[model samples]
Target chain A: MPALRLALHFIHRELRNRYLGSFSGGLWALFQPLIQLAVYSFVFVYVFKAKVPGANAPGYIPFLVMGLWPWNAFAEGLARATTAIQDNAALIGKVALPREVLVFSAVAANFLLQGIGFCAIVIAMRVFGVPVDLFALPLALLGFVQLFVLALGFAFLFAAVQVFVRDLSSALPQLLMLWMFSSPVFFARDALPERYRGWLDWNPFTYYTEFFRAALLGAGSFSLSSTLMALGVAVIVFTLGYAIFRRLNPYFEDFL
Target chain B: MQSPVLVEARRLGKTYPKVFHRRDRLRALYRLLTGGPGIDSTSVLRDVDLEVRAGQSLGLIGENGAGKSTLLKLIVGVLTPSSGEVHVHGRVGALLELGAGFHPEYTGRDNIALSAALYGLNADEARAKLPEIIDFADIGAYIDEPVKHYSSGMVVRLGFAIVAALRPDLLITDEVLAVGDESFQKKCVRWMEDYLDGGGTLILVSHSMYHVQKLCRQACWIKQGAVAASGDVFEVTQAYLAYQERKSAAQPVRQDSPSHAQEFYLIDLALNGDTADVPLVIDQGCRVGARVHVHSRDGREPVISFGVARADGTSVYGVSTEMEKQRPLRVSENVYTVEIEFPELALLPGSYLLRAHALDTEGVRLFNTLVRSITIRGESREFGLIRLKHSWPAANSETNVAP
Candidate 1:
């Protein structure tokens, strides 16, 4: 219970503190998702003239938001979490406490932004003339899974790897760029030729984006089996990431 | 019951592995063919034990690279020990390096939040106490600006202010308190006194004996990765100074044999009126005597050159062959006395060297050179040349002294 409280405590503090110097204040958290939704909707609907997966998909606006917003939560959360321990090197090396709080704080901030993005999605669906249905509620539970797991896994890997290899900082942005492209945001995964499908199965990010778009849009076009495969990848990768992070956490004080 | 040890260490030690990058590290193909770097071992502290209770404050003193900082880091839990263990019970707050971990882009208020969290305070708790910390720091308008604009002294003041306000269960302060001017240093001392009065555990590391002596009752002297001495503040300090004196004099003392040409001999030096150990002080009116040991091939009159010289190569006083009459004496390896009298010696207080030489009556020089130094410690603004002991002129005044 105290851990839950501390997590809330950390989340509130990080957002408010970051907002202190920002011009748009905490609104930037909401604004970022709104802006990305507009850009992706224009590109998919007007520029390319491609139809979204589901026919009653609440139009392209709701479809673009659901897939991209939660995906941002995962990517942004991991980027921040990877650097969490590195940024708090002072606190970790100096004082005695549960050092895990710093990493947990990063995840908490990501969760807060994810919530803001979720609120904006529901509002967008209302304006687009999409009718509410009971099945839409279940999609949230299913849709948001990739956000949490990807964040949890990537955060652990980046934090652990940062201490051993300082060059990770410069290399990470480029690595994220490549990872972002490999996901099916630029093109539909179903259009993949036979040879590329196997490699796409191996790519961890394909699971996060494809499954999320399927759940939120009710796109029966996305195979439920592929979604399960992605979910499986998230679980296995997350466990290994956390194990490596815990094993290396002890000796952090020595090098740092 | 006696106050239990709040901080205890039994053979607490920290060693670091020195990584040796492969010579072929630049060659990617070689590294791919082979592996990574090799490791070498180095120890910062070895087999150390210490105890500090709630009411006790321990002072750590050592020459540079003597493991003082390393021990402090271990006790404060900043660095874990490579072997053994340390048990610290209480909230430990360390002012390890002032202005460390301060974010330059952040304002003073934002940094205060971060600093508080770093010291184990929560956000709401830190915010509740923020006003007092700001007031204590007292850097008025600049407190609202980015910390990058703050001067080094201002940064230290803010760092000290936060620690002073919290008054944690245990405080481990490094030599950073000396970063301020004399007045600021006094303010820090007062804050330390109040903290100590609250029965807080304090571990202080300082090179200044004066500051250490004023603040701490127990002292530990570290030398070459080991505790040289540990006990009462004065005794341990004295032992450390004495050990330093011996270590400095460890240079090989040159052996001189009696010469044939001129009747000359070199003799050991004495400070004050004592002939045993060298006294550590020198001032006006303090007497110095030299007992010379000489041997001559042919019996001849001994002419001596003696002088007290300052550190800068200026001769203060000389009772030499040019000034005084030569005395006929039996010349042998046995001892002879040459005492130069000073009614009142007036000189600035600092370390000075003593020189003595012996020559034959034919005006031929023989042997020269003396001990390394004689240090003088006295009150400030003393008038000099010779120390005159005189009475103030009143009704019974005989004389008024002039330098």
Candidate 2:
């Protein structure tokens, strides 16, 4: 409880400082993703007539919403985490804390924001009568949690590296943008050519979006094996991220 | 049994890789992995052995980048030593730099809780002490305002207030007193005195030797990543002060005036055998002697005189051989040397200037003047340029009647 309380304090501070304190600042967190959703839905659903492969409906908006929300969380969390140490350079260079707190709190703040976005989307989807599968809700929650852990691992790894190679922070968003496009948020994995779909199978992100589809819309190939595989990848990423982070922890102050 | 040392650092050294390019960092990383020597590096701190027992207060004195802050960081475990280890036995609270741990966007109140948590206080404990911390910081309604809105002095006040409330067994502070206003600084010093009085250990780093002498019993002067000197506060601070004076005075040596050979002139002046090359530092009540060598065109005697003044040029005492009616003995055909000695120098602990002059025989016109700076070093808290030797007489019973 004490640790949780302390973590909550940091989380609260992080949220107020980075997001919710100012009117425009609080608006940005919600507006950014909503804008992204609007743009992507406009281009793919209305313009390209992108089809949902296994949805109860013809439109892809509900399908895209399920996956895009989680991807946004993952991407935003990692982006924030990448600069966790760099952003708190003043604090990191001084007072001693479990430096991981910076990374954890960044991810937590993004998760809270993403969680709110997800609920809002879900309510809208249900109101629109897009077949909501309550049964797969637990699996969807598991997928989101997996994404959080996976992002945390990457956050730890990049947060350490960003201190040394500051270019990584500026470079990450481009890479993440490409990564988001490569994952199947606008189209189903099957919509890609067979060869590209095979490559997508190797991409861990594909499974994350696909898992969310299964949970929310019950419209994707719900493979228990792939779900377990995603879990394995999350654990591996977290471990590797933590290892790199701890190895570089002592050298962090040197660069600063 | 010896009242366990609150902090001990043994052969502590820290070297930062002189990374210039991305390749350099990569190579350093490779070396770290392969156990290879760093290609090029700078030792910011090296072989610093220090200890502070419980109830002992030590001051770290050094010029900027002399590793005083680095050593304190090592002792506080903010930065790990590269070669050796620092063992701190007690809970340590360090103020390495003002607002270092504060989140600028968080209100002062929030940062107090957050910093307390960072300093190892549990949430409940931090909450319990919040009121006291807020009261000590004493910034009023500004406490609820985001820290970025507060002034730098307010930040230090908040940072220091948390440390004060925590009251760690060993307090390590680096120039925390440098930022705040004078009144706040006095408040902090007063609090520190009380902390030390309550049997706490302290390690302070400051450019002000006066504060070092006031608060610390022991001091260390770190120079170029090594312990230049360390011992009693007065001795180490005096040595450091002397070194600074010498470095600043290393400007071009004064050339003899072109007309010196045509008139009576002072060729050289030395204070207790120390020339102008090094500043003189002497303890109060210590013997201070000035030797002046003068030259005369003829074997005619000139009035040799010298005076002591505060660094501000306020004259403390001045005397001339003419006033004493003494004749200078010629050491050579045209050279004369006079020794003016103060068996028990009465100047208090402060920087002062000593000027010796050669005047015409009638003492009406000055021929040449040579000046040297001296520091009277002592641990006394007395004010004034000179320590007057006087004692208070006990009041008689008759005089004790109610006024």
Candidate 3:
């Protein structure tokens, strides 16, 4: 609880310091992803005429929203977390504290913003007459936790590397963009070629998206086998990231 | 039972990889991960051993880049030593760098809580100490303002305030007093005195010997990453001061006459009548006399100039025989002897250079310079280059006497 309180204070400071000065302020947190979703919708709905396997054109927006919101949270969390140590180099070089607090606070701030955006998207889905299963909310929340754990794993790995290699901060966003496309953020998994569809089994985001889609739309490929696989991969990434982070934590002050 | 040692560092050293290219850093990290052969590293600190008992204050004195800060960091566990080990017995509160852990965007009050938490204070304890920290900082309305808006002195004030409130068993401070204003520095010193009186162990790093001698019972002088000297505060500080003077005195400077000055040349320069090869050293309030021997090509009385400067090249005093209208006493046909005696040299304790120049009788045109180094030793802790003759009345004396 004390750790949580400290993380919360850092999260509050991070959020307020970054967005409070802008004209749109905290609204920008919601607006950025909405704009991205709108662009994706325009390209898919009008240009590509993309169709969901179980939903019509009217239901496709909510399907995309369910996947896109979690992806935004995961991607933003990792990106911010990677630079957490570098952003606080001054403090790290001086005082001794749990360096993990820096990475957790950064990820948590973005996660909170994504939660708000997810609520907005769910409300908009209801207005559009799309399915919104209140019973499936717990599953969606689990999917969020899984995403957070995976993002934290990557955050620990990258944040450790970033102290030595500053170029990682610049290169990671492009890598995340590529990763987002590889996952089923915009298109349905069924739409992929049969050869490539097998690769989705390897992509952990694929399972995460399936869980979220199942919770919101009740039409995702979520089964016991897939859930176990998701949990397995989450544990691996978390453990590996945490190990790498702890191993490299000592040399952080040297590089910074 | 004997109290446990508050801090102990045994043969500690910290080596940083000589990282130039990005690949070198990566290779070093890879080595760290795989437990492979280490990449080449330059040791910033080497073979440093220190121990501090409970309620004892140790001062670390060194010039900049001498690894004082690194030692402090290693002891406080902010930095891990590359070799050996550092064991600290209790909770440590360190003010390593001013405003180090503060968030610029957060209010001073908010930063106090955050920093307190970083210092291992729980939520309730941090909240409980907030009012006391605020009162100590006394930044007035600025406490509500963002930290970035606060001045440097205000930041140190807030930082010292937090550390004061924490009252950790071991306190490590690095040059925190060097930045703040005089009164705030005094306040910090007063607080530290009280903290020591309350049985707090302290590790203080500072360039100022006055503070170290005043606060610490033991002192360590680090020179080029090694322990040059360590012992009682007075002995260590004085030895460090003597070493510093000798180092400055050894700075390369042309002491011989120039090759082109053929008309007249200063053959020799001596201080305090000591013509030996060793440097001249004297105590404060003692006479310092410079003897200059000038050889004249044409039997003309050369205008001999005598000047004294501090080691840092600041000219303190200069005089010329031409300006004083004083004639040099002739030692022989062409060799003239001029002795300038400064009765009761008022120079403070520091290294100084005595320069004697041989010029034409007109006190202008070509010349040659001969230099000699001198050191003044004094126990008086006075400031500046000169020891002025003065006295202060008794503290708060009501009597007004005209003597």
Candidate 4:
């Protein structure tokens, strides 16, 4: 119970820390991603004239919005949480509380902020006559939660490893970039060459983007088998990451 | 009967891995993940057995790097022990190092809330205690400023205030009193005294023996990462002080070596019939006898002198044969011997040095000197170098009537 309270406190602090010194404050959380969305929409919709490969496909901006919000939550959460332990070296060295709370709060804070932005954009798109499935928004949130589980898994793994190998945090951005390109964040799985289409199953993040697009924009269909597979992958990754973190937890102070 | 034990450690020890290179950390991680044998490490603390019951105060005293802080950290659960285990059953408030867990970028007020949460206080409980903490810190508007902007003393004041407000079952502090200004230190000491009086337990680490003696009823002296002595506060502190004194006295003793060319040279000095250079240990108030053999180059009688000093070289008493109008007895052509005895030495329990000096026949030119260390061992808590003779009469007696 105390651990839960401590995690809540850290989450509160993490949320405040992002906006503490910035002029935009909480608005920056929404504005930064919207700007990124605009840049992507300008490049993909206007320059390349990209379109979803279906007769009744959603507009490129709506499709991209659906995929980008969840992607941002996952990527940002993983990035922030990966360095959580390393960032709080001062606290960890002096205070004795559950170390996992730092990682948990970092990931939770990002997902929370991005989750709010995701809702705002979806509601705005619906009002603008984009035909967003507002009723499916609840199901889409479930998809976001699954993605969070996966991100937290990776966060725990990377955070623990970052303590021993500090290069992980420095090298994380490039790795995430490569991962973004590999996943179906910018394009649908159908856009890939027919021969490579089936390989999307291999990228754990592919299921999240496709699931979000299907749930929010009603553009794609998700099968029961794929849902089970994604859930299995999230659980297995979470278990593995948590196990490694627990194994290395006792020795963190030595390395720090 | 004693109160319940709030802390117990059985052979608790800690060792830090030797990570000179970055690669070593990775290798250590790999080994730890694989459940392999331990890596190369340096032990900072070893075989420490300690127990503190409720309301008991313990003072930890040692030189720097003696692992006193490490021991406290282990007990406070900040550091994991490499061997054995330590259990602390009650809430602990620790103020270790400067600015202990405070974040530099956060305001002091925010940090206090965070600290309150870390101590397992709910939001309402924390809010209830907020005013008390702020008032005790007494830094005024600086509470809203970033902790990084505050002075070191201000940081300590705030840290101590937070800990004081919590009033945890066990309080562990490491050299926190040394940083604050005089008034703040007095405030902290007063607070600690009141806390102790209210049955709070404490484990304090300090370099100042005075503070240790004042606040702690039991003391543990750590030397080279191990307990050198432990027991009553007075006895342990006295032993530690004596050890320090012997260390300082060990240096600059070359002049004590006898050289025959001098007009007068002291050949030997003995304390309590023990002539060896090793320190003589005696109970407090026991008789102390000093015998000296002086060698005179001229066939003339020499004046002998005996002096007593605290181990740190503070002079306590000195007397010469010239003052007593006595002369040393010549036993040979050029050798003379003199002896003095104190039937009841008034010196208190601690370490002291006894010196025997040889002067010329005129008692003017001091030629040679020899010294020996003597330790008075007892359970006396009286202050200063000697135990004064006095009597406490009954209040009803005529001696109690004032003029």
Candidate 3 stretches greater than 4 Å from native: A1-3, A55-58, B1-3, B122-154, B253-266, B281-329, B334-403
Docking level of model 4: medium
Compose the digit string of candidate 1's lDDT tens values, residues B1-403: 8997888889987776544453321232222224444234578788888989888988999999888888877887767777888899887777777675677777888778776766666767788888888887888988889899998888888888888777788888889878877777888888888788878778899977667767888999988888888988866765665555555457533435444444555555444445443434555346555545444445445566667776456778767654666453454534444555544556555445566666655656656445545555553333343445566565543354443
**Candidate 1 residue A168 C-alpha distance from true site, Å:** 2.5
lDDT of 2 by residue, B294-389 (tens): 888887888999899876678999999999998788899989889999999988877777889899889998877787888877777765678787
Better of 3 and 4 by DockQ: 4
lDDT of 3 by residue, A76-193 (tens): 8898999999998888888877888889999889988998788777877777677687667766877888788888888899999998888899999899999989999888788898
| TM-score of the second chain of model 1 compared to its true counterpart | 0.66
Candidate 3 chain A: minimum summed lDDT over ten consecutive residues — where? A54-63
Better of 1 and 2 by DockQ: 2
Instruction: Give the range of the ten consecutive residues with the poorest summed lDDT in model 1 chain B.
Output: B24-33
DockQ for the candidates, in order: 0.23, 0.57, 0.52, 0.63
Quote the positional error of residue B53 for candidate 3 in Å: 2.1
Pick by lDDT: which candidate is best? Answer: 4
- Which clashing pairs does model 4 show? none
Cα RMSD (Å) per model? 8.9, 4.6, 4.9, 4.7
Tens-digit lDDT track for model 1 on A119-184? 666656766666434355456655565557757877887777676556677787788778777876
Model 3, docking class: medium
Ranking of models by lDDT: 4, 3, 2, 1
* Each candidate's interface RMSD: 6.5, 2.2, 1.7, 1.0
Which residue ranges in model 2 land beyond 4 Å of their true spot?
Answer: A1-6, A20-22, A25-27, A55-58, B30-39, B122-124, B144-151, B239-265, B270-283, B286-305, B309-343, B348-352, B357-368, B373-385, B394-403
The digit string of per-residue lDDT tens for model 4 on A221-250 reads 898999999999999999999999999988
